[model samples]
Target chain A: MSARILLVEDDEKLGRQIVEHLTEAGLEASWLRDGGTALGLAPQNWALLILDLMLPGAHGLDVLKRWRSQCDVPVLVLSAKQDASVKVRALELGADDYMTKPFWPEELVARVQARLRRPVLARADRVECGAIALDVAARRVFVGGAEVELTKVEFELLQALAMRPGAAIARSWLVQNVLPPERDGTERTLDVHVSRLRKKLGTAGAQLTTVWGIGYKLKSEDVA
Target chain B: MRLATRLALTLLVTALPLTVGLVFLRERAARSAELDALVDYARGRMESGGREACEDAPEIFQDPPFRLPGDRRFGGPAPRDPLGLGRGPGGPGPDGPNAPAGAGGARPLRGRGPDFQQPPGRAEPAGPAAARFELWAYNPDFRSDNPAAPALEPALRAALERGAVLASGTFELPGRNGLPPRGGLQAVLRMAWTDGPCAIVLARRIDLPAEGSLLLARFGLPALLATLLVLVTLFAFLPFVRRVRALTAGVRRSAASGYVDPVGASGSDELTELGRAFDTAGAQVREQIERLERRERSLRAFVENTTHDVMLPLTVLQGHLVALERRAAANEVPDPSRVREAQEEAHYLGALLENLGAAARLEADELPIERHRMSLNRLIERAVGRQTTIARGKGVELVHALPGEEVEVEADVTLFERAVSNLVHNAVRYGREGGHVAVVLEVEGDEFVVRVLDDGPGVSDEELARLHERSYRTESARRRHPTGTGLGLSIAKEVCERHGFGFQLRRAEVGGLEAILRGPRAKPGGGNRSTA
Candidate 1:
């Protein structure tokens, strides 16, 4: 069954365009133009919600705050506001993702797909891909049944990407979590660490691809 | 440590040295006074009668002219001092034969005050009483010739050898009646006669049994005083400690409540001043929080309004692109008006983006403005070129007037361009259809001026003055574009203020609003572009 998505947006053209994009990506999407009516609907029935702020009847944050108390459904906030505080507020209110307006439909659909895909590679103590095997609980990794030594930071960076294989992890997020505070987290340093990690991984490093302006993605397809 | 505990500990700890020091000083003073009185008694006895007895008759000099311990010839105790020099300060009580005068005066005296004369039928215990003092004599060669004399200490003999006329020492004597050994004090004195000098020794014993009684007498009062001092300080210090704790709790409460709670301090002390200082500081912190909160509220409003304004044109631009994509997908001819509409929407979107960037850069305020020589001539021409599409979309003629020579200002080029763009966009977006907007760049005296004049329906005189308030839109502006951000002109003003430039908004002679930016012209050859 195709996954169903709920959209709460007041703009006519943008809402239609988003619905078409999701439909073209083979997802069933239901659109709600009024925030008031959308508040009455059960969010649990849908696989995901693409909620827009600045609605007519009710603000998107209020709706998100109310729904968060009763359900664990994922919420993707689509707002045109560029202020950092507003995005923080939306995420703090329990939004799974926050995308600004004037976004390419491909980014929206790709982000939506990434949000819907639960991490499958590292669900248990041991994760076995084609060539790389990870002992997540032990914080160790192996290539082709041979132990591969990795630094703590390098292991964390690989584990973060490997958890969601082929999905880009943000450089900002990686800098905040993977790097030690003593590293200072400059982008240059991050690049240096990544290059060192690739060198350490040897030929299996081919699976790690830089997503250009975004960040790194660990592809399971080329790991073998 | 807690305030009250710290205070209690400090008070108790500080009181210890004082108590110990005071007690030590009291003990030293009491012992010294007792020693002085004992010495005085011993010396007086030896100097008056003992020395004369040795000088007049050396045969009975050891016993002071035929007087024994309980002799009764001189009377019950001994010869009384006619000059009253025997009694000394801090002497034993009046019940004893020789009591202290004044300091230990007015005792029973035991009838020995007027020189040892026996009363009729009196049977006084003279053994212990007369044992207090023992007198002996040493010849000029330092020998005690009497066979029954107590041994003369070598230290006293040496003192005599060194030419001292009198010397005294205390010693332990055999106790009578099986009591513990008694203390004995002895003194030696020298007498100069026709023949030679005879050393006379006078001695008095310090009472051991009476020591317990003396301890109570000398130490009891001061002990009580020290106890009182410590108790009073600890109790008095309690209030101060309690007040400090209360003040701390009040400060914690204020911080927990966003520095809004007052300490409600009372009393007139240093602690009260401290509490008032905390309250004052808390009030200032509360004011700062409120100000930050107010700024945050306005910033939020501006962001939302900008998003709405940008989104409207953005949606139009996207819709046109989507339509064009659809027409091309089906191999159909494109509509020129729709493409033009898309171009105009794109132009407005670019201007909106520049405004948003300026607003964001202005808000964060971390990056410093890099100054460079910016030509207003090119800046105005670029702004007009950018806004011409939007102006044409609104059926307004966009025009400009440049100075004959290139006019330059020292400013951050990006910020200056954005500010100019915002002004031009504001004039064009708000101007009336079929009316023209003018952009003029010229140098007036020492300042370079840029004017954006429009032929739109002007705002009220009251609203015109407040046109630069953040997120504040006039009634006509709201009516014309219900989703207007009201951020463009305000951001332009902020850029001007940041550059120390003067910005003005007034009614134009062409029946519209006139916006002006006045800045100091750059010095010749001063603005070199930095590689950084």
Candidate 2:
């Protein structure tokens, strides 16, 4: 089935142009001008949310926050203001990516497609790397067939790094993925949690080696 | 206080006391002189009587009718001539055997009864009114023989013995021997007689002068009235002085503090004039400040609006250029024609943004230029290079007929580049589509001239006159190519003005528009550095 997308924009001409482009790109996209209308729609039905920062009823940042509160749908924000702070703010508030205005139609479509494709390949409800089996659907984990207690955030950190097994992810990407937008957790918090996770997983956690100048990556041999 | 009021107050304060004191002193001197005159009159009368007693003894004996014992009138014993009678064994006797006896066998005087008294040794009676005398005189001899006479005080006697005249002072005479008590004026006249120097003091009570008494009676009331008048005048004038001083100080303070004009009028005086001047000056300053502030605010608003509007278009243009560059790089055999078109558009975009920025800076007076000596030939060569690609694309040739030697002139590098670039761009836009354009740089005497010659249709006189006006595009040029914002010549003109160069537009030798930039040559021995 075609993926369901929500496009929120205020300008009628720009919004119509974007919708036509997305439809041609083979995505089932619906256009909403106001944030209230987009918020009323059920999040379970939509695969991706394309938001414009300068909306009428509510700001795109607020809409993205409200959407993330109810569902885990990925969000892409479009803005006319090209300042770097605006892009960082939208990304911090649960948006998966940001694009400045007067952008190419193809690039906008590509970014939206990337956000939509993220959940399917997000790892089978639970992921296993080395002797560590993370049951994401059940919110539990096992280290070498022995049950291990993992906090929600600790599991999220392991899951984010484990998704790209054997590949180093930047520290910034891990913070963006594992922490809520309003949380004031630091890089030290991530390190402390990783250390705790190492103690819990024992030999399995040892397989999570640190990559200098980069971030931690799981070893292929450790995956079962 | 006002200067005038203060001056008047000072004059009044000093003049009032001096004038009143002068008047009081004059009146006191006049009254004292009058008293002295009265004393002199009494002294003259006493001195005349003393002279007669000392010079003539018979004058005292034969002055009036005598009631004596042998006067051939009343069958009494002949009266002894006391003046002719010699001193007896002891002294002169008060009553002798030949002494004139009146009723009751008492001695009588020549003038009247013996009871008619005289101031002892001073026997002369100048007037017929001897009873009117209030004088009292005493000698020890007279007082001892005449038991009815009163004696003088020892203090008075001692003062008389010292040859002091007018020794008598104000005192009450005791009423004795049937005399009435009276207040008197006193005088002591010293006379040199046969008995030697003696003081005949006479006490007479004179009535006080009416004028002196009246003056004394009114002195307190007039002084009290004068004091009250002074107080009333001061009380009335003090508020005026205080109010005037406050107004003066307020005006002075306002003048000292920046541009705060004094409020309200302070009477119709010099202070009012000063206040008016202050108001005028303050108004002028306020007006100037307000005008400057308004200019600054408008300039800021213009800058903000220009930046906002221009940056939006610039951002879109940049994105387009980036995409075009990506496409050009990806092609195995990049289409040179398309690449040239893209680059031209990008160049146009960059030039447009630069001109807008420069115009905004000029309007805001924020851009400062750095000037240096530059070779005009090199500057022209660089300007030609900027348009070489476009000229080649259009199948046009750009010829540089510059002198072999450098022609140095003073100019800012970036501004000179922009000016030359604008001229080249204008020539490329309006020149014949495939015609040749020649740039020439040469020095003539003290001037360096740069000329851009095109082969397009030449402009009319009117068009050439208004050529450098901002956004003034020729009708033919706009119809043929409407891409430019028509600010090239205007910007070039501004740069020339900034560098103190002269700009002239005329028909080219090759039958198109020609722009000439001329200015003073750099000093000899100066290195020619490229400004652009």
Candidate 3:
């Protein structure tokens, strides 16, 4: 089933654009001009809440704080302030991720998709693609029956991309999911991680292919 | 008047009366000596002449030796001569009666009677006897009908001759009817004349003013000296008083101008030293105010420049949005270029805001850091991983070297990560394409040291020193990242300082720039386990 997102933003044009883009990307996105009506809706039904800091009815952070106490749904704060303190505040208020405004619709959708996918993906203890196997619980990895020592970041990156094997994950999505929020990881940094991940995987690294201008994908050898 | 002048006036007032008293005493003493000498001369002459005459004319002396009352041989007619007999003006001498008696028939003397009163303010003579003398006739037939008639008073002669050669003595004479006995000085002698031996008596009044004159002379000079002392005291301290007044006025004036005025030193005295001290203090105050004003002006400029910078990216993003909208309205597939441009501007705005917020919070002293025990090695890897994609995009290889085990640190995870991220981000942004960027964390002498280095064109020594200044960009940095906010290193420095860590930037060994952050190694159980 496609993920459904509840977006609460005050800016009419940006809000409309984000909703349209998300709908086109084959996700069910409902846009609300204020936070009050969005707060009345059951948060558990939606895959994620895309909240803006500046809203008409209720403060975005307030709504997030209230919703977070009742449920464990993910929240992505899209604020125009781009202030470090604001970002830290939203995260401290139980927001899963935060993005500043004036954002490209593609990056926003990519972030939304990553936030929705993280919970489902995190439930798996073992992540396997081709001969590369990542043991999430033990923090260990095996490539072609040979156990290899992987750095914490390399394990996170491999597990994040290999969650949906053979499917392209946007560079922004991988960076958002694989990197800790406090880290200043960019798309270019994501590329370097992938290259390092490839080297660590050895011959199994061939199964991982760059999507070219989009992101990276891991494929099983039998399917390729 | 100043204090010194008032003091001088007081001295002068006290000295004046003393000086006058001394002068009066000196004058009185000289006059007293003159009067005493006159009396002595008269006594001496009468003694020499009368002694020989009295010896030769003893029998002749019995006939009318004392003057009759009507006789005018003395200074004035005898007291109360009602008939004015002997008013022929044949007085005692050409001079006043106070003069010595001349060589003639010995004149009768008078006491202080109504006809012979002394001047006012004249003190009485020192001796207990009346300061006057009179003669008495020993032969009864020669006496007049006056109440003070002559008595055969041989005891008077015996008493007068019993003393020194001058033979001065006090004797009471019979006064007028119903009057008290009056005392007088008497001098009697016997001397031989040509015929036979005769007895004679001489007497005079002792004046009071002469004695007082002697006392006034004693204190006169000391009073004069006291006046001089007052003048000397005024002269000694007057200059210091004047200098103090001028210095006080100068300091008051200088205070009004924020201590910027110069109080010049003009002498080698203490006042001049005080002036030099004031000059030094004024210079220091002026310099401090100037520096504060300069810093305020720069802070204002920094805010304005930050606002201006934020506007540029916003304008670019607006343009990109307009292009994307027009393409969407045409119902054609939108070109990715417009979207990509908008994203780039958005990213730049985000980075700028982050720097601005960090700098603002750091300066405001409100950046909250919640520290916890965490794996420093893992944090470094994550921080380097965040820059990996960007470094690769710029064709720069990112390298991170860490310790073998978990290096636990008591840190605020977000801020610590941010500090490391800023260094790596700057390295990737300014380092040369295809160059290497390295992040290293290791133990150095009980400190956890983190170093970020890149083989990019490094700054000169001058630029390296200014890297931590807010919004200060070097020449090479400007050439590489034209739109860099220049707040990254400052933010890193502030974070390190807030955490009691040491931070520095220097030329890297890899022919580039290097940033080093050092923090104290965490002790066991010192850090909280909970972290964000």
Query: Which candidate achieves the best TM-score against the true structure?
Result: 1
What TM-scores do the predictions have? 0.46, 0.38, 0.42
Residues A156-207 of candidate 1 have per-residue lDDT tens digits of: 8888777666555556557877899875787678888899988887778888
Candidate 3, residue B459: lDDT: 83
TM-score of chain A of 2: 0.53
- The 10-residue segment with the lowest total lDDT in model 1 chain B: B120-129
Stretches off by above 4 angstroms in model 2 are A1-224, B1-12, B27-42, B50-298, B301-305, B321-402, B409-418, B425-439, B444-446, B453-485, B494-502, B506-513, B519-532
lDDT of residue B241 for candidate 1: 77
Chain A TM-score for each candidate, in the given order?
Answer: 0.65, 0.53, 0.62
> Model-by-model lDDT, in order?
0.66, 0.58, 0.61
Off by over 4 Å in 1: A1-224, B1-131, B136-169, B173-181, B188-202, B206-212, B220-243, B264-273, B302-312, B326-333, B355-382, B390-532
Model 3 per-residue lDDT tens digits across residues B1-532:
8677677777778777767776666545633433333234333433433333223333322111243343333332221112221111112232323322332434443222222322311223342111322332222122222233334245645554454233444455545465445543344433222122222333333322233443333453566587677768777778777888888888888888788777756799889999889889888988888777766765675586578778888999999998889989999788765675576566657656666555545554343665655667656755665555455556787766554334667766556766787888788777877887777776655678887887888888777765655442222212325333256676677778778888888888668888899888777566453322
lDDT of 2 by residue, B1-532 (tens): 7655675676568656755775577556633433343344334433434223312332222111233333422112222223231221111232432222222322222232331333321222221111112333333221212243235556655686675554554445556466555333344444333142123434332322232344444354445555666667677777666766776676667657655655445567776776677678777877777767766875676566556645654566676667667876886555566555555565565555555555544444544555666556655655666576667776666655544345777766546766887787777756766776766665667987777777777787667766655431222112223333256677788778877899887877558788899889888776533231
Ranking by TM-score: 1, 3, 2
> Worst 10-residue stretch by lDDT in candidate 2 chain A?
A114-123
Model 1: per-residue Cα lDDT over B1-532, one tens digit each = 9766776677668766776777688666644444444455545544544444455544444432232234322211332333232222222333443322232222222222123322211222232122233345556676655544566778987897787866666677677667677664455555543133345554444344442354455456656776787678778877877787788898888889887778878999888898899889888888878767866865775677577777788888899999999999999998877886797676667666766666656765545665665556656765666676667767887766554355778776567777887888878877777887877776777788888888788767777755655431332212334223256777788889889999888888767888899989887567552211
- A1-224 in candidate 3: lDDT tens per residue? 68888888888888888899999989998888987887677788888889998888898988988889889898888877734456667766788766655455665776677566653434688887778888889988998779988778888888766777765555655776687778898987888888988888888888877753246777866332
